[model samples]
Target: MTTKVLLASADERTLERLSQVLAEADAIELVQVVREAANVEDALTRHPDVDVLVVDELIDSGRGLGVARTVGAANPLLGIVMLVDQAGPEQFAAAMESGARSVLSRTSSLAEVVSRLESVAHWVGAARSAVSADARSGRAGRVVAVAGAKGGVGASAVALLMAQSLVSSRTVGLVDFDLQSGDLAAYLGVHTRRSVVDLVDIAGEMTGRILRETSYDVPGGIRLLSAPNDGERGEEMTARAARSVVNALRYQYEVSIIDVGSHLTEATAAVLEEADVAVLVVTPDLPALRAARRTLAMWERLVVRQRSAVRVLLNRQHRRNEVTESLAAKIVESRVDATVPDGGSPFESAMNTASVAAASGPAHTAAAKFAAAVVGPVDDGPVDAVEEAYAEVAGRGRRRARGNDAGQSAVELPVAFAVALMVLLLAGQGLVWGTGYLLARNAAHEGARTVGLQAWGPSTPGAARADALDELSGRWRSAATVDVSPSDVTVHVVAPTVVPGVRLTSSVSAPVQREH
Candidate 1:
């Protein structure tokens, strides 16, 4: 039988090119091609028979990693292949981290693309066989997290859609732990009087009935543990409390999808530690990429120190940005596991209305495809060290930008001083002049021996005149003449002669322009 495949990408050229390549493959059928990430969920909703998903490395709006994770967590049996621009060890590693079964660079030959499709088709068949066996064996509960590398990467949106996809046949639970600004309950249009706080408050007394009672039902019987509307209560849900809630739901639900808010707070860290799998969400922007890099580094450190399973997701991918899946993976030193498309205005509308299913436009279809991949079959492999290193470097770079200051204080201080000088020259002339004079004097006094300059004024008139001229010439690197009769130098300081924080003492033989 021919394998049914879905394509999720933001670039028209890429989609057309890949579709043409796949069309030539006799073993694969291009069942659907979605332009937006949000449509993936709807596609899965409408066509439950898709065997594999070919997604771009980056989506237009949400993080591609998040989309991939959502797909993997929701479907767990679908074959996922991420399309990246450049092939590198780091890119490949990040792709795998995001839950992609395979990575294909856009530069691959059409024939190679066909060959990969055939291979993925075979893998899909094998996965289906394994899933059938697992079903018969009655062991299929999985806990997955949709977490942002930083805040606002759309992890919650991905979680909502993933839960929606699984609600059809299996018991799926959506837990929102953003606490302060969670939108899970609002997205599902469920008003829960009870929340994770309630669960935490009744930790010892928790029961299946209590959980069921607190959870609000969405379309297709998916249950949602809505976050407390009160920001203070949400804040009170500590990492320990979140762990308790997740552990409780793990026993009763077949699939538990979590929306971990941005920031590795104690609560989020706790969730990351306990989750069977984590989807690290990021965007194409530098800040998001940097955060994702840091998040990955933190996860690796935790893994080495504590052992955890973490993945990556790229969201809001567009064709215009400099940051592509390949570049992102290279920077973060990991392969992109999956990707989603830009969901467009339709997604925003759905988000506004508080309905995951209502977002059932084109983007939802793409989301469903991702969801299928999440619950589908997968092959576990060892973590890539190169990817980890890249993540470490990128994470370190971000930390430095955020004032990490790891053993480079001396270097940073000089650079910072230079920058301050430049800023003063451009924006604060009066303040800069006053501050620069005082600073320069102090620096000259401190490093006088190094620069061979005198620190104080001379006592005798003749000596003072010579000393002033010498000091001015030495410090300012400009000619200075002393008039013994005149008290001070009328010497002019030219442009480029003034060193930052350097004071010039001089007596001029002739009147001159003192360029301040």
Candidate 2:
């Protein structure tokens, strides 16, 4: 019998395009085109004969993976392929961990799509044959969870960059589990109307038809299953639903990187249980360190019992008052896994301009080092004395803040200054009126005047010649002048310049103030 394939996507165009591509393959049959699973239970109930299920990375109802898991759970023998915009190694790895049979990028050529479909079909066929030959073999794939101990630890940034870094050698899928306030799509520079929430309602009946309608493909072949930007839907996910999603992704990609949000929600905990490696991200600050310590303790009490792997990463290591790696390790009661340096002014400038790829200088290098550490040896280098001193200062600062919260408030005052400046600038343009021009002109004139004065000697006839000219010009301009002696005096333009459209100008004299 010809292999029955179901295509699910958010875009009708994508569905039509993919349907057309699959139609060209003689061995595959386009069985269905669904925008989403029409209730996870029902979708599986209705499509019992679907040999292969193709889904978009983003499904409606924030439950695309739930649909995949539902299908996979109901029919373990079924083959599943996820259509992603980009297929980075980390994301592909995550997808495989989620239970996907294969993953294809939407940006890939029609030929590539066909090839991927054929490959998935072949794999499914071969796996069935292999199962008969050896029924006791373990599954191959790794799920890595990138989680922040607290908010603003840059966990998502690390996860996405790590996923992008892995694309060269591995197939990866990036799952944004933040549900609410998830910025994966924005970070990846992808805009899609449909998110995982849209898939939940129809997740039950999701065939290939439903999966094709929702996912957006990104560049470099990394598949992103983004969360709804609306924080309201965060509670929409249940632990069971989250696990379903993760399971579905496992079949399609070899590795999966889940950006677990700050809080260890039940849904996230479900994912953590399945993850092979859990990367706990934190900064060098006291609050972050405390949170990391608590989180580590909690995980040790909970998921660590299951033998789930965990690693800690320190981000923004170059801050002037940051805790030393040694102190940070001691606080967490574990050795520091890796340190990501702060990508200075240029890096932040690129991020401000919304050019993540351009801002990826230090972040890229740090990500490579981090990847190497995760995959290789844990480098335990000696702590620098300077770093220890800084850590001592940081610890004192934390203690002071804890005592009275005064230092914390004081530290936040500068941020207020920045906000106030931004508000003033935005509210009125005249706030900085002539500011740039005045600074530029003052610098230029100061340089020129210094050169001119150095060329003339004090008490010399040439100096007198210059001073007399200056006195005459000052008198002409009616500027306040004080005589040094016979010729020179310092002139001050107390009022606005008399010249048309000119501003204030002031002068200081040395020996020329009392010229002989």
Candidate 3:
């Protein structure tokens, strides 16, 4: 059978090179060629039977790999091969995460290119055949990774609550990928010795039975996969193992929620790359906003995910917070998709009692709505009604609070006025003192200049003193004193300020220039 191939590249030289090379191959037929990322989808639509897609890494302004990721997710059975300028571990990992079956350098020999093309074609054929035979084949589950911008941002709580919110409508699996500081199990008040680390070695061949044995059945029908108790054991779950585990989880559940904690690691990178929705949880503060930006930048640099693809969720949102949804979005350069309000005491008590399932407050309701908004289309009928009802009650409380504050303001206004008046008077008095100091310093300098001159300057010590005193004017002339000494050739000036008995003084000395 001839293997159909689609070649996509914006570079004409690359297109000519690939076309020439592919023309010599007898078994491989180039069915379609697309120059832009936007046109690749249409080309695929035209040629649905194409077995392998070979894409230039620099196509579509260097978003070719991201395009591949979108295409692979839509057509999981299709085979993809990325043509990179340089092929290394980083590029290979990025390609794999993008759903490409293989990555090859653009400079690969004709024989190597043909061989890889054939190999990917063979795998695609086998995969399609297997899916055709299996009656249980269905759409894989959606994976949502909840990552904190910094520690204490409540990523674990959000993950658990989101899972709990989703379990009512879908099968939800919650995994603690925090490694050293994972507390998903403790959050639910459950103890389990087995964790995800136990299945790392066998993740590739993970079965439903094996997963059941390793996972715990927590409240609200959430499948809980706890992290290892020992932090050192986290190293055993490598990136490869993390990817395999995610695949298995996707196959088994309708929705998998992984709390990747605040820190990024090898394993978390794999999880983040695999997640369908990567939600970054951040507080409405400057430091948390900065951390969120840094985290998104790191993901982009590593090619783990695109910055535009990340959803930023604002936690601890309050009416009085200086940072709003629009402001935060501006700061992070991403849209603020959803927000969880401050839950107050009821929310805190629920976590303390290990009864998050029973937590009922504005925050809990908002969290559920946030999960719905992030995961799938939200039904806003009931959500709007709930919000309206909360707003009305909150409105009445706000009015009462304003009334209480009015009384306090009445007492504070007089004190504020008095303080302002005192500050203005002190400022004017300081200005007068500064003028006195300047006058005294100028008189001293004038007298000193006269001592160093011979013919043109003041002739005697008394004349020098008069020159120094003349520098002062207004009230300063009578209040100020100037002294000149011919023996030491020193001059001094003193002046009184607006403040009674407080004086400003200056002194200067110059060598006497006697006739040589």
lDDT of 1 by residue, 289-318 (tens): 888777777767766212134556677777
Query: Which candidate number would show the highest lDDT if scored against the true structure?
Result: 3
lDDT of 3 at 166: 86
Between candidates 2 and 3, the one scoring higher on lDDT is 3
Q: Which lDDT tens digits does candidate 2 get at residues 224-303?
A: 77888787887888776666566655544556788988888888888888776789888988899889888888987875
Candidate 2 lDDT score at position 170 = 64
Tell me how far the alpha carbon of residue 455 in candidate 1 is from the true structure, in angstroms, after superposition: 94
Could you give the C-alpha RMSD of every candidate to the true structure, in order shown? 30.6, 32.0, 36.9
Count clashes in each candidate, considering only residues at least 3 apart in sequence or on different chains. 73, 95, 0
Which lDDT tens digits does candidate 3 get at residues 1-516? 999999999999888888899999999999988998888866876888999999888998998887886676456678899999888999987786566889988788889889999999987775554343321223457799999999998889889888988888787899999988898888898898999999876654454545777999997789999999887888888886788788778757878999999989999999999988999999999999999999999999999889999988899899999999999999888889889998878788888888876567787788889888777852222222212333444566556555554556666856755675455445434434434544454455456556655444355677667666655543557666665665333334443333578665544443333443
Which 10-residue span in candidate 3 carries the lowest summed lDDT? Answer: 378-387
- As a whole number from 0 to 100, the lDDT of residue 294 in candidate 1 is 75
What C-alpha lDDT do the candidate models reach, one value each? Answer: 0.64, 0.63, 0.77
Report residue 237 deviation for candidate 1 (angstroms): 2.5
Q: Report model 2's TM-score to 2 decimal places.
A: 0.47
